[model samples]
Target: MDWLLNADTNGEKFLVMLAAVGLFVVVMGAVLVAVDRPRWVPQWLVVLGFIGPAVLMLVFGLVYPGLRTAYESFFDRNGENFIGFDNYVRVFTQDEFQIVLRNTAIWVLLVPVAATFIGLVYAVLVDRTRFEAAAKALIFLPMAISMVGASIIWKFIYEYKPDQPGVNQIGLANQVLVWLGLEPYQFVITAPWNTFFLIVVMIWIQAGFAMTVLSAAIKAIPDDIIEAARLDGVGGVRMFRYVTIPVIRPALVVVVTTIAITTLKVFDIVRTMTGGQFSTSVVANEFYTQAFTRFNFGLGASMAVLLFVLVIPIVVYNIRQMRLSEDIR
Candidate 1:
């Protein structure tokens, strides 16, 4: 026991030694079963032999690591001196943390609804048209790009240069403003509005997914219902409003909830484009900044736990909606 507690091991070496001994015992038992004339050994023993490796791997890999992270969230960065909910309090009270929470709420509210609405509208408008596939393919193209890649592309679009002699603006948005005889604006650096600009990247990527889902839901509507509606003189905007929207409500809910979940965990675009600067940080990016950049592991973990708490209800609701939709169908 004294040897196991010695500074040379730091306790981890003892765990390793214990594991090695257990593994050796298991292996030797298996070998003896194979080599010796052991008629009494049952088939369940062989099944246990196969299951042991997998069980050990799972305990060592997932279970151990998750427990360790949760444990570390209670301690300081160096894993010393327990300081309970102080990290959580810091997250709520600090100005920077408040900004993060506000930005996250804005993102949660804006991106999903806007993206889903745009996608649904686009899908319905193009549903029976000649250019439907082409339109959808074009819109869906952005989803294929990695988040970092998309951020870089949008960064170029939002590029800003101070008004100078003979410097042509490379940013498309500023170029458009210049064409309209307006002064060029620095999109990324602008506070309050820059967050929305960052959000555009997410919306651009997610809108296509929403469109595809809603389009499928629309197509799944029975042709007999459409014919009956037409027979009753229901057509145009009235028919769509009275009929199409009601039928596709399930899909709309799914799309909005899925987008909300995605928005809650959004980190890459903010990290790549803004580096969590200029009041553009959200919870996910703030967690990274706290955990890795500032070495405030406890605060970072609390942020992570907060994020998980926020997301769980959304996911559970989405699951219930899906099940209800399935039952209705």
Candidate 2:
């Protein structure tokens, strides 16, 4: 086992990979044999053959890591000493980490709400437009870009230069402010507002996804219901409110929660744009900062655990909402 882990050479790494693949094949072959010889093997064994590997993988990959992280969260910086609850307490009580939590809350609250609203509105507006596909594509283009790429794009979009004589403002935002007879604003260096600005990039990236999902949901609204509403003089606002919205409310919930989770787990944009400085640090970014940058495994693990705790509720709520929506349907 020690030799297996000490594969420094390329040949050794290749052998390790080959061995892993061979092991997988062998396991599958054994399972298939058992499944084929069903009379000799119990029916449950066949079922287990199909599902047991996946369940075991989950236990090893997801469940075990999660449990181990939780356990490590209770230990000290090096994972050698016991320091129960202190790391968690520091995460909440420390001003900097508190800022991280606050920023995370802001990201979770604002990004999903703004993105969903923009997407819903855009989806509705372009539902049956002459250039519907083009319009949707324009909105959705950002989602195609990698988060790092998108961040770089927006970094230029929000670029700022000192308001000095003969100095050209390269950032679109500052140029807009300059056009309006105002000084160039340092978007990333400012607190609170900088966080909001970083959030706008995420919203820009996510709105298209929301639009795509909500658009399908909107289109799926029964024509009879829409026609009935129109016959009763319920057009425009009334029709959309009573017919379009309620019918797609489940989808809207799904979009919001999906974006919320995505926003919660966001790290690249903050890292790229501001490097999590200027009070714009979120839990995900801070987790990286702690675990890798600071090398405080205990604190990092605690942050990881906190993130897990925070995500669990949102996920549970999403699942419950999905179930309720299905039940309603």
Candidate 3:
């Protein structure tokens, strides 16, 4: 038991993993055997046999952690004293956390809208074009890269060096400025606008995802609806505004809300590029910085809860939109 608990060695860790897998297999096997005896076992017991483990896992993993974090938010930094919303008050009122909230708002506002727009336009333009696959592949390439990898790639693009006589600009963006005979600016370290620069990376990565989803949605639009619109003299932008937009509205909402949720939880890009410095921190990264780096458990838990609360409304609205769309169909 001690060895299982403290598995420092590679062999011990592998053994522990095997033990867990074996235990899972044994438990599942027992459940299946019990369920297979339909005549001997009650129907409810058979249903429970299938669902009990999953329910237990969900309760242990999600519900308990969420409730625990919410409870912890009401305590002090050390988590020893009950502070009762003080941490949440600091989150809303403090200048530093105000900046964090502002940055998060900016991220949620811009990334989804900008990414979805670009994707929709791209999808529309390249819908049936000759270079459609190639163009889509080029745009979707960024989605294949991990967030940390994408951040590193963009960090190099925005890399800054002193404008010395001997120095050459390695960053593509800085090089463009140099070519234009303008001095290279600090892209990441500069406050406020630096946040926008970081946001661009997320947009670049998510634009591909938005395009993929919206493209499929566009393709799913009935040809007869488009034919009817064309016969009615609707063309170009007007056709898109009326026929295309209305047809894909549900998909558009899903894409936007999905991206917004992702944007709200954006941490890797900001953490990798700015480390939450220079007013570039969002709620997710700020939570990590508070709980882990700064060791302020109360504040961290509060931010976590705040993020959860913020996401709930968007999620509920997304679900409602999806259901409404389904009902209409």
Candidate 4:
């Protein structure tokens, strides 16, 4: 037990992991044996044997932590004194936090719409084309990269340097600006607009995901419906606007809601690009800044709770839309 508790070396850690896995296997084996005895064991007990571990895990891992965070939100920075609603009030009333909220709203609103739109358009244009696979692979490449890695890649793209006789703009964007004979602009350090530039990174990453999902939905549109639309002279833009969009509405909803949720909880890009400085912070980054960096547990927990609250509706709507789509099908 002491060795398992104090696993300092790599080998000891491996052994501890093996031990845990072994225990899990033993417990599951027992449960399975119990469940196999359907004649002897009650149906409810057999059912419990299958699902009980999962229910217990959800309670301990998700439910408890969520409840604890909500409880901590009412406490002070040190989490010792009670300060009901102050942190939430500060989040709304404070100018800095207002900016955070605004940025978050912008992200949730823009990323999904822009990414989904771009992806839908791209998916439509490239579908069944000669270069379809290549085009998709190109667009979807960024989705393969980790968020931090994507942010880092875009950080270089947005990098700015002074326009001097010998100084060269290394960033792709600044280089384009210089090519157009325009001064290199600060992408990450500037306020207000910097948030949009950060949002662009998310859009770029998510567009691939949106494209993949929407493309499949587009392909799944019944051939008979498409042929019928074409017979009605519904071609080109009208065909897309009327026939395609209506058919893939559910996928669009799922894509938009999923992206919105991702955008709502975006932290890596902002943190990596600007470290949430220069009025570019969103709720997730702000939560980290408050709770972990500033040691303001109460405010941090409030931000987390606020994010959770925002996400719940989107999740519910996504699920409802999925069910409705299934029903329609």
Candidate 5:
């Protein structure tokens, strides 16, 4: 019994050990029951008994914590005081908060459209090429990298150095400017523009994902329609305009809306690269900074709630798009 609350073990470690011991006990008890051949219980009951633990685990682990966070959102920094609309009001009325909202809007708007457009073009061009797989793999490689890792890589790409003669430009963008005989620009440190630059990283990563989805959609188009279009002298751009675009509309909608949702929740790229500085903060990153960094739980909750509210329209649109897809099928 003393081992259950041992002095050498922290609460986390104790809980972990207890879980392991409980698992062992359950396994052994199950084996014993099997050996004894108890006929009173049905086989389905035994199977469900095994599954019950996993269901309970999810309810405790995921459902509980999310509910707890929602409850805390109405509370103050220490989660003691109740300040309902004040935090939410500050989110809209405050200049800095407005900037965060504006940046978030830019990210949600630009990243999805730009990424989807690029992906659609790339998918159409590469669909029947001899090097299609290689081209797609090259494009889709970014999606393989996590957002945090991609942000670090792009941070170096947008890196800046002082205008001093001795130090070389660290950022690839600045290096390119130097090569083109233009002055090196401070990318991350620049206001407003820096937010767009961060968005470029997300676009770069998500373009691959959009490409994969749209490319599959393109391939699923009937050969008969393409042939009919070509026979009608719609060979190149006109063929794509008349044939491919309409055929893959459902997939395009899914890609665009999925990327929009992802862009709305973007935090790692902003957090890792800019640390929410230089007015480059978006709703997701600002929520973390306000709630965790500044310990202003109420303000952070309001920001999160705002984000949730914004995403609802997109989600509804996505659902409608999915229903249309099912009808088409």
Candidate 6:
């Protein structure tokens, strides 16, 4: 019992994880055995057996928490007194929050587009190259590392040193400048540019995902379509532009929209690198600051709701594009 409440230790967390797995297995096994031993379980009950646990998990995990957060968004900081819409209004109109929104906008705009484009080009270049396997693996390695780990690695690479003579520069960025006979620069201390550097780290991590998804999509393109294009004298950049991109257009949209949603909710890179300071705070980081750091639960709830609202349109667009692409096929 104490172990359940004390999850700070790795052992306790592992134990709790095991208990959860054990509970799930027991419940599922009982359900299976009961269903099998029954005289004649109805078809609806069989279907329910398959979906019931998932529905229960969702109702308890997502639906209730989402509704509660929405409700709390209209209340005051402490959630005691009702303060309708004040938190929401402040989130939209306040100067500090505006900066957060601005950073979030930059992330959503840049991460998806840049990552997807770079990935598309890389995928095409290495599709059947001599060193295709090795090249793709090297590019995709970052995705295997967690975002927090990637941020830490890049942060070390972007490390800054005072431009003092006779001092060896430790950070790679500074070291490069030193090699070029220029003074070492502060990568994280600089304002908006620092945010861009953080964005680059995200791009590096997400480019692999985009590349993998887009590569599969490209491979799934029909062999006849590509041959027909070549027969019609379409090759090189023109073929890629007209044929390859169009054929994989649905996947492109899904990848972009998926990355956009991921970027909108990005927190780890910013948190690990900048701690949301110096105008680098985005909506996700701001939400954490409000909810946990500042103990402003209501305001945090509003920000969460705003994030949810922001993702809806992109998701809807992705669904529409996917359906339209299917219709075209």
For candidate 1, write residues 145-238 as lDDT tens digits.
9999999999999998777779999999999999898999989999989999999999999999999999999999999989999999999889
TM-score of each: 0.82, 0.89, 0.93, 0.92, 0.85, 0.93
Q: In the order shown, what is each candidate's alpha-carbon RMSD?
A: 8.0, 3.2, 2.0, 2.1, 4.3, 2.0
Instruction: Give me the displacement of residue 247 in model 1, in angstroms.
Output: 1.0
Q: Kindly indicate the candidate among 3 and 6 with the higher lDDT.
A: 3
Model 2 lDDT tens row, 1-329: 65478988898899999998999899899889878985787889888989999999999999999899999999998999999899999998998988998999999999999999999999999989899999999999998899999989988988988999999999999999999999998888888799999998999999999999999999899899988988999999888898899999989999998999888889999999988889999999999999999899999999888888888888899999889989987
Off by over 4 Å in 5: 1-47
- In order of listing, the candidates' clash counts read 0, 0, 0, 0, 0, 0
Query: Which stretches of model 1 miss by more than 4 angstroms?
Result: 1-63, 327-329
Which tens-of-lDDT digit does each residue in 1-329 have in candidate 4? 78789999899999999999999999999889878986898999988998999999999999999999999999999999999999999999999999999999999999999999999999999999999999999999998899999999999999999989999999999999999989999999888899999999999999999999999999999999999999998899999999999998988999999999988988999899899999999999999999999999999999999999999999999999989989987
TM-score of 3: 0.93
Pairs with backbone N, CA or C atoms under 3 Å apart (clashes), candidate 2: none
Q: For candidate 6, which ten residues in a row score worst on lDDT?
A: 30-39
Model 2 TM: 0.89
* Candidate 3, lDDT over the whole model: 0.95
Alpha carbon deviation, residue 27, candidate 6 (Å) = 2.9
Stretches off by above 4 angstroms in model 2 are 1-45
Question: For model 6, which pairs clash?
Answer: none
- Please give, for residues 73-120, the per-residue lDDT of candidate 5 as tens digits: 777777889876777778889998889989988999999999999999
lDDT of each: 0.89, 0.92, 0.95, 0.95, 0.87, 0.92
